[model samples]
Target: MKKIFVVALGIMLCTGISNLQAQNDNSETPNFSKLDASPMDLALYRNQENEPMARIIYSRPQKREREVFGKLVPYGEVWRTGANEATELTLYEDMKVAGETVPKGTYTLYTIPEEKEWTVILNKKTHTWGAYEYASEEDFVRINVPVRKAPNNIEALSMAFEQVEDGANLLIGWDDRYIKVPFKESM
Candidate 1:
């Protein structure tokens, strides 16, 4: 009986050791991904009731000592509004943009940048990568906002929501220029 118990114990220990070695094997280790050059960020705005009113998800790219507006981004051309993927905006409820009532939904935000102003567009399309396949006809609403000089040079692209008496404004700034797109609650 003692000899049988010893043999069984030896077999169990061997199996456990083999399982542990297999788990620690580095031969098939996964190739870990590195950090993104332009990290994605989110900005949210909540109403007085503490309910989320709007949210934006976008990648913020650094200026990196390059001319952002005209050279790096180019002028009078559609830009993804950030880096990897096109910026996405979600409205929890129906909101008015540029005096036009936009239904509550998720949309891609694209921009036609220019020297004086930017043509901000909200499209019905989502999950788009950059503005390579952007279609003008898919646009739900288009608003042209004049560009304003930033107080100082912005190293990275940034966005935020500022509450106002009527609604709120999405402030976007990068390099030395910035713009404001307003969103008002639909009545």
Candidate 2:
């Protein structure tokens, strides 16, 4: 009778341990490659009739938390706007930002963040990793924009469009900071 009780207790412990291991393995990070890739489109400006004036299509990587905004990202420095591959910003039509007119083209996007403002960059180079290899000679346009505090914190960086009377605000928000790039449609 004693031997049978001991065997049953051992079997129950082994089963419980196996079940816990299965739960941990199931919560592991998902393989993004196996998932279908969906790129998002962000419209920048609006016409007099409330139509989209310019659009930017981009794909964000799955991983986060590396040296963003301090070490890997570096404080008071330029970032390549995204991870893994270069962050691509496509201009479907001419638009104006900070008094500069940008023609329709695909450009690599970068940013320099301060506590109160951010400098948005449009570089001629389109494909690269982080800004570790960035060159000022490749810059096509640079514009300074004010940063606004977000009511709710965003874990990941996100961009969206907000309608205005004469144009649209291309808003980029992340980590409690928000920046609005005012884009006016070209007449």
Candidate 3:
């Protein structure tokens, strides 16, 4: 009886240790910098009652001679948009931008940069490296937005949330160019 009890106790201890180890290994990497950057709020169906969601914001580097489109960024590639993971666009609620409605879900954000304009894509996949293996089939929505020259050069790809009368402006800027797309909550 004594031996059986001791063995059971040992087994329990081993199981507990294994569980703890697994948890440690599976823990997600901390995103401390995200807290400091301004966030782009997304509220879907404002008339309805639902919890608002938020995402940490980041932009690609806008270094000169870095090669963008057919070079650094590559014409057709799956760009992650940042250093760690793909560019992350947090959705607070289901919202509409550029005349398209996007559901309340985190998406791997990408853009096909061109001289005249850009085709921004919001894909269902989140974690990826550069846009090397981009698949259009994975895209949830694609919007064509015009780009404008910035008075001042932007050293990094930048995104900001600006308040408007009815909604907010999701702005993306890089180098000497900037683009703003309006995002409004759908009723």
Give the alpha-carbon lDDT of every model: 0.93, 0.70, 0.66
The digit string of per-residue lDDT tens for model 2 on 1-187 reads 9999999999999999988877668467453455423233354555666565766545443224443445544558887665556667776677776777888888787888877778888888877776776788998888888878789866666777787766677787766667887876656
Question: Measured by TM-score, how close is model 2 to the native structure?
Answer: 0.68
- After superposition of all CA atoms, the RMSD between model 1 and the true structure is 6.6
lDDT-wise, the better of 1 and 2 is: 1
Off by over 4 Å in 1: 1-31
Better of 1 and 3 by TM-score: 1
Worst 10 residues of 1 by lDDT: 23-32
What C-alpha RMSD separates each model from the true structure? 6.6, 7.0, 11.1
- TM-score computed on alpha carbons, candidate 3: 0.63
Top lDDT prediction, candidate number = 1
Q: Best by TM-score, which number? A: 1
lDDT of 2: 0.70
Question: Where is model 2 poorest over a 10-residue stretch in terms of lDDT?
Answer: 35-44
lDDT of 3 by residue, 28-140 (tens): 53434544232323222222233443354453554665655457665444455544446767676777877788887888778777767777888887666656556789898
Backbone clashes in model 1 = 0
Give each model a TM-score: 0.84, 0.68, 0.63
